[model samples]
Target: MSDAAVPDLTELLADSPTNWGKWGPDDEVGSLNYLTAEQVLAGAAQIKKGKVFTLQRLIGDPKGDPVWPGRNPAVREMTLDESHWDEGNNGPAFPGGMHCADDTLTASLQGSTQYDALGHVWYDGKIWNGFDARTTIGGLSKASVAPIAERGDAGRAVLLDIARHRGKEYLEPYETFTHEDLVACAEAQGTPIRPRDILVVRTNHLQLFFEKGDKFYSDFCEAGLVYSPELVSWFQEMEIPNLVTDTIANEVTMDPHNGAALVLHSALMRNLGVAFTEICDLEKLATDCADDGTYSFFYVAAPLKISEATGSPVNPVAIK
Candidate 1:
């Protein structure tokens, strides 16, 4: 294709990590292709005790706390028809019909446990697999989050508890890790990441939020993986496909690769095409894994099929 037709996304692709044509030209699911039937089967095989862990947080408004400026916390309004109300207060939801209630939910999909669609991140004017974001900017149209639901988000999930491995309950905010640190954690935790596995790294990034509440967690910076070209390269080399964390931003706020500025997101989500999951509640799962000496589980997540949308909310489950 001529430069005019293609727009020379080579520099953007080269500068950041990407999976432009890895699956194919028309591919929209990005690295999600890694979760194949075989991969799904492998995930299923890991379930021994049939124990289950819900990895999503209880998503409610932070008691009306201003978590972020302008972004409204999720609000749930429940309604019951007057016909359902009875004599005093315990009346049936419906006078003649069965009692029923309805809820209207206003949510920030990515506010809690969620998988970020490939379309959710873009660089150099294009998305993964060469989709022009300008034309497909209609959220779920181009690289929509809905496809993640089709894929079933089912696979093997491995938790690399960095804090536990380091003999601590949590890493201090702003503590970041390089590729070597990941490898070390893998070794220390005895968790080997296999291809086609979904990786969940727990750095105890959410401890502050739990201990001190939203104000402290929102006010302060947090610790996470050190973002760098080298870290991106490591993910590509391992081909693990997806990563979720108990972190608001999957990586630390500052860039470690000489100031690439969210290059970690670009490399992993945009370039390499790994569907990224963020803000997951991994505290319970981490504790369970550490107690049982098990880190592998069958993981399942299905994002809302909001067609052409940039991203959607999800509640991923881990079956032990």
Candidate 2:
């Protein structure tokens, strides 16, 4: 965000309300610390019909129609005898020609449904809590995405279908919603924003992408929450441990305030120590929430165990 949009750094630091030292030294879990076992039990109580929704998009090659140029697309390969692994040449085959298959996948972890770890963002050569990123974040970092996966993020998930509240299938291109819009959405949905809850916002951009085309949508044209100091304050007030959205970026692709790139990524992940699950498929969730008038459910996200990575692919689930 622009310097004008953000408050004075000195003033913000002086009255910093971040959970830096609250979790103790060498703490990687940030707001996730608030997700107690009791809270998980309480979150599980939201389930009534036991309906499970997979929040991840299935990865696949797009048949030469990549959303973004040069970015890696999902590639699936077979490493076993199915791929011409002759026993005479490669000398590799299953015993008794059982033809057991082993497959390997090459894909971008953050290309589709993903999570941004605490170490994913860096500003001024430092990470969250002012740790030197050069040393603290490497192949093995201080705040890798692995721990969040190991723990299995589980809690109450609340869906804020802003598009539905606006009576639209999706928000328009490049539309920017504000913190006020979120409050209004919650009021309309009759769901209270609770602490340590996972927030899922449906912009329906995924619908547009699938309909209009990925390249058209991936060109940084979509609806999303705007980045502002007030947005940070909202996160602080809600104390949400995890955030997911159908939009490409968590915040608007182009800053409405100062034309900054991924400003919320830095402010939230790098400064406030909040993580994100971006580019999720929330169309069904939004439609269901609007239909049943039930926007709350049990959310669970278990990231792939890729140690020391800045982020990882995640298939977050919502059970209602």
Cα RMSD of predicted structure 1 = 5.5
Model 1 lDDT, residue 311, Cα: 66
- Alpha carbon lDDT of residue 238, candidate 1? 74
lDDT of 1 by residue, 27-113 (tens): 877777888899999999999999988877777735432232245568887766554475776655445657667778887766666
Looking at candidate 2, the ten consecutive residues that score lowest on lDDT are: 61-70
The TM-score that candidate 2 achieves is: 0.87
- TM-score, every prediction: 0.86, 0.87
Candidate 2's residue-wise lDDT over 192-212, tens digit each? 777777778887765666666
- TM-score attained by model 1: 0.86
What is the alpha-carbon lDDT for the whole of candidate 2?
Answer: 0.74
